[model samples]
Target: MRCNVAPHTFRSSPYFHLTRPLTRRSLKSIEDGLINAQHLDDQIPTELAPGNAAVLIPLANVMDVPGILLEVRGKMMRNHSGEVSFPGGRVDATDSSYVEAALRETREELGIGAQDIEILGQIGPPEVNLRGNMVVYPFVGFVHAGSSHSDHTNTVALDEPLPSCDLDAIRRNASQTEVDAVFHLPLSALTSPARLRASMFRGNRPYWAIGVQDLVSDIPASFKGRMKQIEHDDVDDSEIGPGKYGNLEVWGLTGWYLYLLMKKLKLYY
Candidate 1:
């Protein structure tokens, strides 16, 4: 269920000169380097929403490019439509754990099966989205190449970089009302503060809204020219710091969680 954004209309923002060129990182290095991973069983505040949800902070390599996976919610959804968010949904009573719930949602929304995901750990505490009145528990999962699907046993493959991780192979959910688009935002660009901007206003109130433009360039050239990303994104005249950032703004609870992930991973000094 992907909508075509016109080719000539995506806003052209100034690009930041990255100190180093973006390259695929070694998965083993990342796993060994990860710290401050929280326990997945941490409690959730059920009162924050009718039913809390578990979201996957999916990290994978797509077409040889390593990055985090995100989605554009379809406008007709019950909540959080037309927004950028990790793949997830409300936790069902049958769910064994938030980890299970997150993986389940990843399968439903992105068509990736549980065998392809390697659960790293939780990100932090559950985030409360006042706009959606939703409480979401975020978990980090490293997606592996389809050829190396976990036996759900020995995980020796995760000890090294498996170049086969590809999202293009999965069949996308065909329902337009559920997910409009699924794209991976590169981690290298995501780590640099120079490559990101935080808008300070939503309406008249103050907030730290992050706008990430890195993925704009990642979009295939043929389709990027016509998409007015910020238009559907609902960006106002709020300041986005000193330099230009891409129009793919991450606002509300998603923005808050993303900022925390950056700090937790220590992706940048």
Candidate 2:
């Protein structure tokens, strides 16, 4: 891993040229920027106030590349059932800060804890959506897997740790009660031209969405069929609500935050 590579160099890096393989050096650079980055004040809408909700964007510690964790909400979920999203929920009153809320929700949903995460930074200013009457703060963090870096790994097992950073491990770790399925998306694929499509919400607001093929291998059998159903142009009706970008639809306010995150990482323009 190159210790001194700058984020700007990513534009010309071999990583992008070779089918979007994310290297450790590239992830390190992203982490460095996030730690020191200022909040995105302008991007956050002002109509809504800071609320008691947050989400964790968890990046994994794969050797050559890192992957992000996402959840498919259980079919029984009251809101957004079977939807893909970051692992998080409304902040509890006992929680001290938004960070704690994120970690706690992650623990409840994915079995990840604050001890396992090295918080890079909050991706954007608090996200405020008038439609849902919610304001959510987004936290970017890394979950250490094994012995790569002692400082990064949480050796003290707090409750049985969710071992194995593989695809199957991610799927098995997801709580059946909360998550229908779990999948890991390589950081590189988030910005791939072939995997991205420009989508519009409310027939005006535009954001980027990811295609099913962009997923980092091992998609569940159930999700594959849904992905194919949404791959075409039949569900473009804004009046019907959020549109899918293949099966893994990343849209609505969640899509907005994803766009902000991609820009923050210099992965997407």
Candidate 3:
């Protein structure tokens, strides 16, 4: 769908300057380099069922800056229960493709329509297993800042504004069973290495890193080697531990998924 913003508005944004010249070859090179550079995917357990799907990592401009939209599932929901996650679900019979599934789910979950979103290419698909049965497909989409949509039309109402909810609610809602929450990390954080750190979680539990393509440059060489060692290590004796950094606790599939996404996206430091 086309955005309503004027062409002149694009001149002031960094995206226009930074992404305008990205040719197919360069984009492919970046994607291919990520695929070959790490063994993050080796960390996911093979027992999970594979399923086709998609998720929109919604980006909205807030205060002239880009931020992601995330949702805290209702406490009563089954499966992940109240955990944080993007607005997405498994591909269904009516869906045409992964992208279509993501868009449809987003509309259902957030009450945002397809016309409001700007498809800025895919961030590719990352695998996530839910309830030991389904492998999730994730796609990233961007929406301009100052964009607004009405969720009131839907059966459920998302009363909180996306940005305000991120700062006030996401962390507070996290707990053992109802611990699902989602929040957007700034793009600057994705490109910078200064904020990245190697974290050992939950009694020094070792997790298989699956998604590290976006944050590879920020990782230290020593840590990279250690990760490689962990990947090849046997899983028999490993224990789950608390996260070494950040408020996030790394345990179960959730931690593993986070590690994979960060590793694949290279969103460290």
Candidate 4:
């Protein structure tokens, strides 16, 4: 397995609020400045791992607020059930490039077509998932829901604390067998220092986690029945609220990648 990147330094910043209300323009400003990950020497080096996979950090303007798109794997999924994640999966043998593999997974998992996504570039310092015995490559891309796309709904997820978007039409293309719900998290919410923290998993391995504070109810019923774990940190985080409760944290590889992405944009709090 490849070595992991050391965690970046976290510092208090008076400049945090200035990035809000994150907009298309502000994110686009740094597009050209980002490191270019794809290359003319395009072999995926799948030899580095027994398996290969890719995921896209989807960027979109949902409800006119620019943010990242995420998903919850179906309850019946073989692994990582009820967890929030980006749309992607294992790289296929026929896949010519990691970019294509990432695009295909997004289309299959979210119904967002390749044509709708403008590939920004690949994300660097690829992750090696020892449990899966594979290398996972991530890419940054922009997604534009066309006029034919379903009407937008309010976003949901701990990253931005949105209720799940339930637009029927927009999800027509998504493979419900694999995906339980879709969410668009505002960049500002993800960058909010109050929502982000460092935590230990199970007991020993320390990882970064984002606190949503939403109850188990914020997620789908299917996920609720299959739920196996609940974790909450932060004294200020509420434990009880009406019929709805909160606290779906993002940790492990997902949290790490989010840190890397947000750090790249100078949005990490």
Instruction: Find the candidate with the highest TM-score and give its number.
Output: 2
How many residue pairs clash in model 3? 40
TM-score of 2: 0.70
**What digit string (tens of lDDT, one per residue) describes model 2 on residues 172-240?**
676887877776666666656665566654344455665543452444444444443355433232311
TM-scores, all models, native as reference: 0.66, 0.70, 0.46, 0.69
- Which candidate, 3 or 4, has the higher lDDT? 4
Across 113-146, the per-residue lDDT of candidate 1 in tens digits comes to 7887877656666755545565678877777765
Q: Which residue ranges in model 1 land beyond 4 Å of their true spot?
A: 1-50, 131-133, 148-160, 171-176, 192-194, 199-246
Stretches of candidate 2 above 4 Å error? Answer: 1-28, 35-37, 40-51, 130-132, 146-150, 153-164, 201-205, 213-242
Q: Per-residue error at 80 for model 2, in Å? A: 0.2
Least well predicted 10-residue stretch by lDDT in candidate 1? 9-18
Give the local distance difference test score of model 1. 0.55
| Candidates in descending TM-score order | 2, 4, 1, 3
Note the clash tally of each candidate. 8, 0, 40, 8
Candidate number that wins on lDDT, 1 or 4:
4
Each prediction's whole-model lDDT (CA): 0.55, 0.59, 0.41, 0.57
Question: Alpha carbon lDDT of residue 143, candidate 2?
Answer: 71
Q: Is candidate 3 or candidate 4 better by TM-score?
A: 4
